[model samples]
Target: MEKSVAPDNNNLAHSYNHIGGVYMNIREYSKALSSHEKALKFYEKNLPPNHPDLTTCYNNIGSVFYSMGQYSKARSSYEKALEILETANPSNHNDLATCYNNIGAMYYHTGNYSEALLFYEKALKMIEKFLPPNHNNLAHSYNNIGGVYMNMREYSKALLFHEKALNIYENTLPANHPDLATCYNNIGSMCYSMGEYSKALSFCEKALEIREKTLPPNHPSSASPVVPQNTNKNNTYLLAASWTIAVTVAALVFMPKFRELNCTSAYEGGMKAVIWTDVLQALVMLVGLLSAIIQGLIVLGGFGPTFSIASKGGRIQFDNISIDPRVRHTVWSLLIGSTFNGLSIYGFNQTQIQRYMCVRTTRGAAQALFINAVGSAFIILSSCLIGIIIYAYYADCDPYTAKFISAIDQIFPYFVMEVFSNIPGLPGVFLACIFSGSLSTISSGLNSLAAVIIEDVYKGLMRGQLSDERQGFISKIFSIILGAVVMLLTYVVSHLEPILNAATSLFGALQGPIMGVFFLGFFFPRANHRGCLVGFVSGVALPLWMLVGSQITKNQRKSERLPLFTTNCALPINETITFSSPVRSDPLLDLYSVSYLWYSPIAVSTVLLVGLIVSYLTRPLKPHAVDPKLIIPIDDVFCCYLPKSVRHWLRCGVDHENYLNERVCTEFIE
Candidate 1:
């Protein structure tokens, strides 16, 4: 250091390169370009034309150009960088692999997927030879190749590469490292696209767990490997299933008129027709449920023996209050979680909301809501009664143990078929009911999805005005596409868990966040749209993480089930029955063991908390500026505190004033 050294342009160029890198990472693209250009000039002036410093400079410039979406310029710069790297290290080098990867990215962004895959493979091959097996950069190359394959719809190949990347990351990175999180996220997304929801959810949760532990509160990284939008298809699917059931029942029971009635168009006539049809369906469904309940009671010899047998079978779980999240059922989880789930489904779901809007008056809407609640309660009660009675019927015989049924899920269907075999037309009616319900759900899902796309996405993006008829036509096309896609996906739904449990689990995971968003919009006037979005996203993400982790842990700790037996049970001569032995469950982490029933409540609470906190940090919307109709009044919630006379008087005055205000706002806004 004491010796007088010549002014080293190499060091100056290296400093400039470092500066350019920092600028690029901070997203100051112009400054990054300037710094990189200066570095390139210094290298060109003072160093050899083929110097590595000049190569680095060109690559940096290309990255900056890519960030700015100057694709052609970026490609040219990348080519220049690659040329230098190839000349310097022709056989194998890490820089060469990086250059190839960057070029692949260029093709990928331009929608030339084939070319992108070709370059990505080239990069992978070079990296495999030059880098160590557990190198982070090696993982990056594998990930890139996997991503291209995923885009190409080659799921198996994509999974193989992604797993390779994951293995490398697991070996080299810390348990909670961010890169590992990203790897989990990528695999999760790929699995989701392939319709492997359970696996997708597991991986996504793993990523979320790692991020939560490693990243700071409010850090973008805290939500890394965010669940992809494609995973949301399940929600739509579930909604469709429900709607299809209702519609199918209506069409089958009502026949030709129901078939002719259409609700696709959001017009007065169509809306009215759909509402009347819904009411008819509801009444029919209620009647059917009541008949089933009466029949079940008669078969089970009244409530006493049915309750006793169900209790003996350990099927009644009302008293469970274990805080362990891994527990399958608990009082707190069921009551709190199911409450939120029900509320969200009935209150915030588009299907339910649309039905309410079709009513002529708010009072009519309220009446419809009341009818819905009553119907739902009756359905739940009927289901419980049926389950108890079925258990009683099988308690002595044990159908599964007797080899009459293969699985628990088949027991109910077997019972139905057997019980109604001699009853004229009853079995057919039940089958018809199920068919109608499913069809209605599919139709409704397609219609709702199309409507959302046309109104919110397509129309908003387009500048040219479209006629109502033209828009309707486009929506119809979208509906066809959605239905076709969903039908094709049905094939992948094989080997799933019980339908009711699967549906409920998916709904709980989805509905909580959605309900939270609605709550914020109605209850918290000060919450801005940005805050709502953050809250909604985090709300959805956290529950998914919890649910997936809980399920995975439960699977790992799954106890082997012993064969069921009874005094009258029959078995094949070759089969030997072994009774179940109690196995102590391993302790799980707190968040990993929560009950599935608690998913919705946890999600709603998380959204509210996160939304409120984030809103306070950002600029909040003014309370008075928000739509008055959207706000929930404190008086309504605390109405019990007021005397009946006072409540009635306040309602008379307030209700009329609100009506006048709403009418004025409607006119002014329209």
Candidate 2:
């Protein structure tokens, strides 16, 4: 029956070899050895002693023995395989290189470094001759030799080989590939051995960063179980602090040069260059976001299925009209609270105000604002769609619940890596998009901050004057100083979970009062300086106190989150997962549980109410005494359809006719 089915002995032997491989993969070493020995018996009976089939059989047997930790038997089998390969074809071949690497691994495992080095070099030479320069096989050979050198205490040689492997890996592998992390770790060990502590730390950090990106948070490899005995714990802290300071100082010294080379053209070329750069960055951000959304939709088989899955999972919701402040994303909070926040940002923020000043006319600035509003809306909608897509993809297998990531914020990046890892350059484009947005924001913020400090404080308040060159120098210095301050603040904010809320809450706390002051000066002619001062102080204090108190009490409140499931998680049979119930707090702690969205509205309303009360009580400015140019003509701008009586009431005592006459006289004078 066997002969009728297959006359060829080689074919029957190949079946046994495949069975052996399967058993080997499942770690059933005894069964794998039995299968490989049966294959060997067949190959010996029909094939020549030095046939490639016999050589492969020997290699399979050797692999099983290696798995069984019988090094002597493994080495003998490997030697037989190599001898057969050498006798069959003496010329260099990939099979010969692989055999050499396997034998080298055996020797290395047995602590025979010299023999390992000899065989590893032989494999490396053969690989270099036959394979392309950046082939992964060549990297494997280099890494094998590097390991031998490291065990031999030859730090320099180990470093050179490890770096060669790392170069190939960086060029050929994905950014967060495990092989790259291994190479980094090897190089770091070599550096540590050579007493190059800083370089060691840098490479170690690189390895850790890659591991953090790729591995589960609870992975054994992610833990630091042991530290080097010679290493000082305090030195690590000191080195980290020193490194941060060094980077900041280097940035201070070199950032001006970098900005001059890359960004000065935009600033010096005026609004056109700046606008074009912003447009390009916006395009990049949109393209990246769209790519992610498109990829996610495709994975989910289209928008229909994606939304269906998300809706089923209870991720799609829009009718949350509850007025409860403790509710995180109610319609009332989003609309009313976000309106005040938007006003603080777009209406009165210094960075935005600087952009407004760049326009030659109010009409041009208004056009810019409209365009910005449309673009912002599009981006926001795209982000929400992305959130839904991510939810749908991970509906069954939630990464956070599976411990794939340590924080909720890491989910997006984790999603990108999981989905786009197979497509080269897409991850890089996403990263570039993130950095582009960050750089634009930071640069604009620093520039505006420098301008405010120099113009409002140095010149206006201190009465300081300097030449253009001196002023330019001082502005750069101030930008560097502000940049450093921002970096420190970033470090502090990094510890806060759900950083988006923390950041927006902080922004509202600080900027709400500033926006209120702007509102008082622009529309309320009766608002006195004393009223503005007191109102600004009150607005800042209230929101800031709330934000800080909420942060302090955050642990006591239940985190508002979408449902997560680990029912489909690929956990071991013996492993058990237990989820703790949400923390319960006293009713008195509810004050700190207010939605972060409400902070801006609360601050703005407080300012408006306080400012108006103080103005009336502490001698308000008379309508005639107030300058027409100082107050915006609210009635003239928006109340043209209303009756004269209604328009007068809407003006808050600012005389529109006087403002119109004054504007006409000014235009005539000009």
Candidate 3:
């Protein structure tokens, strides 16, 4: 038989390299390394020393090593790639940028910040020289440099470069693009670090909004957007929203100048003053609510009579805890699910964390948390009572039927207007309180967003330090942009379902997975970042899928509409308003019908379960490698009491006790 001609070495090398790329994406690091090494061997034998194929093979190998946490090996591979690139291409070429960036990353991971900065700056300059001003490559370069500066604690330089990246992304990418969201998120983090909480919040929200639009809800990004699609044909709404956004943006952009020319006293208020101002704002709200309640009581006689009238409407019952998860609320959902929901909201929310961090001591944070819980309870109870009172007054005479309010949500506002109508300036005072409350909430959120952008995204990327004045200047400008972004979201919210309902559902849907990740980090030492990330994505997707399905089921529903009361009772008997009931029952899909209350628990449970499984399946972090501080100290106590069988089943390693002991020792030493 004739000897079979061996496949061309170059072709074989290309094939192996292509295979390695696929393996790398799927995170099969060992397989990826094997394929890339084979490619490199073949390339070396068949191609010239400085061939581009050799450069690619070396770069791929470096990336695989980096992913494997083999920093030294990654650096060596990257250096080889850089050598090949320098020989094969000119000094100013974009290919050199990639090698430089890779090497910079290697140095960054290895704690050689100075070398990282040098290499990153070199890469940035090289790319800037060849790439267009707004090129995405330039954005990448700017972002990398910004990140380095942020790590070095040079806030102003970081902000400058990050803003450059963000500006470029804004100019070149779509509004909802994921890359733009990344930039926004980074800037938000940076602002957060600098203590500009409101601005940080606004920028973070912008990032979230963008991510929701671009990435699929199940993506291992942030809590996913529940809305299925980004584009809508509501041109009129879009146009109106665009106009509002423009005005808001203009106002925010010019706010600092306006402050300079006008309210020079604003920045003079220190943290203590800010806290006092918040207290005053809270008092204004309490006064408004108390005044409204008093007026309501006077108008509706005593509590007993008002309660009797409302009891007839039958809207204040809460005994609906059926096994079906699709029910809106149940005793089971409220007690159990709400705990998870609350934990998710308070435990891991960056906004809450930012506030807690402002406290001078851990004890202060604890006290603040306790106060917040108590205050929240009081507010909720008071609000609920007010609602009951309103229902009692309106039960016999529906406001919608009487044309007293256009929407159900407006009933309270209308009642406020009616009650304070006789009292001169009282209504205005109440309205002002409401306005101030809104302003405070929005301002806080915006500041927080700006902080996150600056701290997380921009701070580690720049080359120099920033003065306090310059930092404040950047913060103010950033806050304006974020505020405008929020205004745009308001428009989107208006076009959606009732804001409160949508917001509640969205929160429940998103919070579960986030909380799960937090618990994984704090409670499960075996859980690696990859597993948590994967589980988070899976967890988010499950609830999102259910929510989307539920919405669809609701839209397709054909059944008797819930009864609406009419004014016919007050009118002549002959003029009674009668509604025809539909014959079909609106049967909901099982998963879709699951109560919204259960979403948090389901999400939390799913993430935890999935994360545990995935962590075990993957190369979990060795007990010795995990930082003890990251794990909850109390968790070890719980683990210690577990049955031997349970421990064995969990592969709670034989050295687990020693691991915890070692960690404690490390903590003591540190």
Candidate 4:
């Protein structure tokens, strides 16, 4: 029997459409439309009109329309794509997920937030089975969900979803890589919004530093434009932003220069000194920022601490290795679970991945990771001191803190705001830091996000290969659009109050479901897609519901604390409420609660067992979908490759504990 030949046109169209999608991401709808139309024409020539690739074209076109804010056209395009895809791929094919995802994105753009979520859920169901636990595409869905929550004033949910994406970024990508920067910026922005200015400053500065090192001199990546290229759209905009940042820095720096130009005032004197001093800081910062992306390493000292130390109520100190999974930072959980988390953060995130991919050996990558851990420790320690500084400053406490301006999270921003508000030149220094953080994140995300869409989602699914030049072109287009979106969102971010809590909860909530799905897939080979879908759905829904309930409970608690003078009373704050006692051991006690520490492992366990059962029951995908190596028992040969931390566990007769699939490792790496 002659072998059935796969159509080559599918490959060509797929490449074009995929690249086109990247352009659409940057808000270059016209370019995207052209690419999709070409893809559609090829689909018509090579395959039937009802072929799934055709649906992609329609879907993309509609997405462009939606991006352009043409709701009617966008909906029509989605409907056409849906009709075609359903006919060609049906419920089971992976193509359906993208189609569904496209619809969800449109609904979101059109302000049909609830409807957008509906389609996102549908698309996610399909992907939970096929993609890796650390897949970036899956992260996008999580991000989309988070964005919805953000729109709904569910700051917690928004942060959760964004963090879900960031968690994957942390595991899979490098610290200085552009994508990782996005995660950092995102997390930082949330912290900033939540009034954790110190944390926000730290995170943002880190992100900005990374971007400065990674992107070409003129790239515009600090924003999220749907169709932005990884590179600059025009040298004009890139030059403009650079000049603006430079002028801002100089203007702030030259407050003293102006005085030498003979500028006046105590403020001007302070500003000039501040500007010159700040200029020195910016130049020094350039070294850290520039070196970061190229080297996959960054070393940031604390933003010098003041004498103030704010009291943090909820904190965790060392504890015994208890059997209880709920225990915070048990010896086993931190050692075991954190290793997995670390692996994912390094192995899968684009930031981390892109960094090491350029290196000569795994040893180099490992060294970078070591540096990262060390750097992280320093940052945390410095933050603790900074927190103390805050405690000292606010110990007496001022009741009238503005959520937008002077919240705890706004420390970094507040500091910057203060520079301009009181001392003149200081604003220039902080502004550089802000740009360093935001731009780096936007640039990194734009680059990595584009790579994934083009490579994994497109190349993995489509049959053809792209030339390197074409790949470069595609990546360039995506970078711009993704950057613009980030910028737009930044503008929108000011609107979100109660930012830190929302960001944290949002991230934590996403972690459970996403981590669960992947854990189920990677650790359990027997799990079919049907089980995957069920587990994934459950993972998302359970966390979402839990998050909602938690929010409601919080609101209820607030309502109970109403002041004495309300005629038609709204909810009240519960002044009667008291949290756990302070830990004075180190006299510096602040960490995530125990419940959150175990959330990842708990969610993973839930998804795996639940997915296993679901797979056993549903049997969605063929056995081929579950790589045999993952399900089968492993041997001593694998021990050589294992990280030293886990090597002993395998020897101690616990190889059964989430065995790594050798095949899985190669799939993620270059």
Candidate 5:
């Protein structure tokens, strides 16, 4: 009946093509080839030799032959397709480019590099004539040609073409696009062939990063040899341990000389030396941070694009004002909780107090405090900006999710290696800057701790004064013992996940109670030593309980991660890809889930509340008997707007008149 409709009917050819397409989709290559050949026979008999239909029919046959690994047959069919397309539609540049690309792919697969190069160049020329320079079609042509050059062992030439493709893809496609992965893989292979192992490893890592984001978990590409593995983990750990030991030994050996140079009296001379060292370390840290920010912004084109992409990805978030104490970041936590945290550090911390005492006058101390505040703000802002830059760079491809790193804390170091590895000495400089910051902090802490032990504990208990030489000797001994203890504790801290949070929690839990005791002594005249002792103990116990409970139940209340996608991953042929179901979590509401930011506030409030109650119940100190010098005279400084009578009433009967007159007389003398 079909033959009766018309001899060699076009409709019959169309039906054969439909059948061939179905067979092709089902992987029945032989059946598909047969059906496609039948279609070609009918098309040839019904239409002119230069017809577009004949071109498509030949291309279909070429695809089936290619799928069957019949390189010769595929090349023959692709050549026919190219011939028909050129004769029938010479002005159709896209079609001509595609035909040339197909023929080139076939020749390349057949190991004919010269023929493949010829066809790929033709395709590239055709694409360039019509498409824009950064068009994906042009990139495809470039990639095909690059592959031919790579097979020909013309590595430099291969790299050039591959990089051209990469440039186009990087500019035009999404960061984690599968085509970008393929381009990265090609360039990585080229670099490996050229014996550029470092560059090869970097490119391979980039390729794997994209693949992990886009491809299925069990994809063959996930296990491909082209992606380099990190096989030097033990060596890295050994090197780190060796470096730490060397630095520690060196510091210990130089302790006496260092004390002679920096720590003459635990006040002005020692603090001046420490301050100078800190200034140098701060400069190095700033340089390292600025370098990372500048290079990252450049790679992302500019701050404009970097911020735009991050904003779109929901990384530029600052308006999370929810008052939920369990939320990780909120305006309330940042403002209220951070204020408490800062007060504890600057007001009560021994290290900061020693620095303040080093100043010549109260005005000088105030100036120093203002300067420190500004410097601390700058450091914090710079750190945050660096984090944003990192997010913008890996917005599409999360290195953590991609399994390139085991923890989120590693991202910064990983980013440094990825971006700064090519720049000689920059990575080392950054690492040195980090170590310098650590050393400065540790030295300051140890210095202040030794001073406190000698001046506050030993002298107070013995009710005696020591000579400068004896004091210095004791300080040096204390420093050695403290350093050893800190080194031991470092191993424990290193094992903690997200060390920043752990450190902060510990700081608040331990230091908050001590800060509260200082507050009680300075501001609350009625708070006796016994009340303070009870308050401090209660404050420490409560936060410690919370901290320990939080750590124990942290896994149960895991926060939702930012969205990640693998939609751009290429699927393996004839393989079933199954996505795992999302795991559902129903966390219990508990005090332990409170954010770490709230720890300081909780401890401070607990101490204030408990100490006031205890003081009242246990026959509080008579305000009249309290020494005026022991109190801060807050009413005089902060309540001076009120009349003297009102200020006196606020002073809780503690007579500060003598103290105020003495201060006025001293200022007049100065």
Candidate 6:
């Protein structure tokens, strides 16, 4: 009794739909768009224009446009989607909610707050009647409504929705569940906006604590840590704070002209010495990191974002432990961001993978991952202690107030600049270390981006065997081109701390929407492709709206609006800060009090909620209709976590012990 199925128009269209969804999630927008177009053509030819599937096709197109930030085009496509869905679906059916949410989001993006609220309300009412009260989808509507209020600076209204969302989520989901924590953090942020520092700090700390408990010790958990408080009045904290100020002024005047004066004679000699030294130290950094950090800086000129500190004769510090989330920084953020950053640069990165794979066995590779996770933990803690000690140095020997470099990220670099500049070959070594960092990072990105393009984008358009040799050649070309791009980027990225903040935050802007889509794919079995597609579009649109709003806010007097993206200290860090006396952090950095770490959880949850509501009101693709391979994992995507022993067995039938040798491997010194 085998049921017969044919690869007809429905099947072909279905295949293209799933493929498009896959590409869309990965940020391969162009390919995703093309795939959706192919599906649309097949649907139009095979089915009537008003077919339910055609509505989905329109919605899919809208989604791709939304991701690409083509708002007008997205709206047009979504309107067509609504027209088809209305024609095919009865009023009050749950499916229309998808269209409602998306269209609402388009309005939201256009800054039509009232219209956005109306549409969101409409979607919320429909879901209220049809879904369970505690359903995640229901909570999403609350969050969405809250978001509109938040944008309008209606703190009271926003807080109302945030609390409602949390009530449902905290009771139903696990404590470590990221969504619940986000609601807490979001609410905390709302309080901060209202000048309720104690309340705001309370919520932010709660969210952060949850994250710290749940995430891998090496992963970025809840990102918003309570900012430390500033204590002054003839104390050590005041002196360190003074040193930071001094460095800030001095660097502003002298360094800019020094580069102008020194020119090429200084450049070539330094680059040669630095690059070679950096490679060796960069390798050494994998093990004896603290010593390497100190020595590497010795080779470089100064301690700053662009150089080392000893070279500059200055330092940065922190006073007491600040539990205030509204403060600019916390132990959690530095540690969490560092952890996540390390994971990202190492995990799924081809350059790191290449190095590990070169080892004889899977066990060797796994050992590397293991060593990395464990070693990195210690390294992170060490960095924290180092920051503490150096700041102590500033307090002890109050350096001149004119020593602060370009931006805060420069603190470390300035330290390097100080340590390395005076020595003969030291600056060369430090420069080498910097180049190696750039190389490793850029090389990994080159391989990853090329693989994504070739595998997802080019596979359908061109034909050839994708042999390892072919991949190698393509990767090399990618590496070269990407290398040039990095150089250009590096040249333009001079204000290191601000650029670092912006670059990481730029990634922040993407994580929310992408993670939301992935969650739907993995867990929401009932969510068909149409719902998936529409939801994703809405999810991204919300953040893009946030970004646009931030840009517009930058136009207003800083005093008028609720501080959104503007970099206010998450807490006041100066010797004195109050409602009247605000601590001015690095004016150059574009971040507000909220760190980029919060973005991952917040962004992911937003996409999921928006996407789910939209999908619930739209058509769900038939699971069996899509290729099993497309839906299932053929290999662990987290292949990076392979244990050293098992990995060795797979790679080469090599003999290896499960236990790592306890003996220290070497006494080598850089």
Residue-level lDDT of model 5, residues 181-292, one tens digit each, is 8888888888878877678778888888887887655343543434344323465688789889988987888666656676432342455666777777889988888888
lDDT for model 2: 0.76
Model 2 scores worst on lDDT over the 10 consecutive residues at 571-580
Q: What tens digits encode model 1's per-residue C-alpha lDDT throughout 182-233?
A: 7887788778878888889899889878877765533333422434433666
lDDT of 3 by residue, 1-670 (tens): 0134354447777878889999987666789999999888888887889888788888789778755545446657777888877777765388887767766765554456688789888888888788889888888878877777877888788888889998998999888876677677667667777766566667778877876666544222333211111223364588689879978986889657645544322133323333544666788888888888877877777787777766655556677657655556668877887787788778877667767888999999999999989987987788878887776655444555433344666777766765665586787668867876776566566666666777766676764786777766666777778878878888766654445556666777787899988877776778887889899998899988877776656533322122234321121111111112223434446667676777888888888899989998998888667655556643345665877667644543334556568878998999
Q: Each prediction's Cα lDDT score?
A: 0.68, 0.76, 0.68, 0.54, 0.77, 0.56
Task: Put down candidate 2 lDDT per residue, 211-296, tens digits, no spaces.
Answer: 77776653334432111322445777887898799789878997686466454433343333345556667888988898899888
What is the clash count of model 1? 13
Q: Name the lDDT of candidate 6.
A: 0.56
Per-residue lDDT of candidate 6, residues 211-267 (tens digit): 787754322122223221111224456777977997888689765654554321112
- Which residue ranges in model 5 land beyond 4 Å of their true spot? 1-273, 460-465, 558-561, 564-589, 637-647
For model 2, the superposed segments whose C-alpha errors exceed 4 Å read 1-277, 460-464, 572-588, 633-643, 646-653, 661-670
Give the range of the ten consecutive residues with the poorest summed lDDT in model 4: 568-577
lDDT of 2 at 336: 90
Candidate 4: stretches off by over 4 Å = 1-245, 248-344, 399-408, 415-426, 460-463, 487-498, 548-553, 558-599, 619-670
Total clashes in model 4, counting residue pairs 3 or more apart in sequence or in different chains:
90
Q: For model 3, give the 10-residue run with minimal summed lDDT.
A: 571-580
RMSD of 3: 27.7
Worst 10 residues of 1 by lDDT: 571-580
lDDT of 3: 0.68
Clash number for each model = 13, 0, 60, 90, 0, 91
Q: List the residue pairs that clash in candidate 2.
A: none
